[model samples]
Target: MAYDLAPASVMFADVADVESAEMEIVHWDGGISIVPSGPVITRDADGGELHRLP
Candidate 1:
């Protein structure tokens, strides 16, 4: 018989947002250049930082 392995739990529900870091955005023309780093934070329902992945 085959068994189902479906996930029955919230992966990142209880995970709290500790801090936020910047994700560097790069642009290269002829050489490597660092442009800007965008917001790498997950926001909650009230526009708050939820969980920052990296």
Candidate 2:
């Protein structure tokens, strides 16, 4: 029998800095996945790219 696998939600915390900030990424089957090619960049409310993650 074939089984359907639903999308999975992954969360990553800044363990290096031990900050309260956390990042969440949702993976949908057959959908586009957000893979960070470079360092994680932070953005502002205006959709601007801030500094990269350490």
Candidate 3:
């Protein structure tokens, strides 16, 4: 039997994104080269948001 990976990939990617914390920069790393991190949202490949996690 073969495993379907598309779903798994999406799950793992979201987990990584949230756990990665997108991190916080300190004085030693301060700058405007940052992307703010927030609540995780699951979406379809069409770019339509499906759910925003609480």
The most accurate candidate by TM-score is 3
Task: Tell me the tens digit of each residue's lDDT in model 2 across 1-54.
Answer: 111233562223223332444544444563322234334554434556544554
Q: What is the lDDT of residue 11 in candidate 2?
A: 29
Higher-TM-score candidate of 2 and 3: 3
| Ten residues in sequence with the least summed lDDT for candidate 3 | 25-34
Candidate 3, number of clashes: 0
Error of 1 at 28 (Å): 36
How many pairs of residues in model 1 come into backbone collision?
0
lDDT of 2: 0.39
**Model 2 RMSD, rounded to 1 decimal:** 12.8
- Sorting all predicted structures by lDDT, with the top scorer first, yields 2, 3, 1
**Candidate 2: where is the Cα deviation over 4 Å?**
1-38
Compute the lDDT of residue 9 as modeled in candidate 3: 38
Which RMSD values do the candidates have, in order? 15.1, 12.8, 13.5
Cα-based lDDT for every prediction: 0.32, 0.39, 0.37
lDDT of 3: 0.37
lDDT of 1 by residue, 1-54 (tens): 111223441111122322553333333333222222332343334566545443
Q: Considering TM-score, which of the candidate structures 1 and 3 is the better prediction for this target?
A: 3
Ranking by TM-score: 3, 2, 1
Worst 10 residues of 1 by lDDT: 9-18
User: What is candidate 2's CA lDDT for residue 51?
Assistant: 44
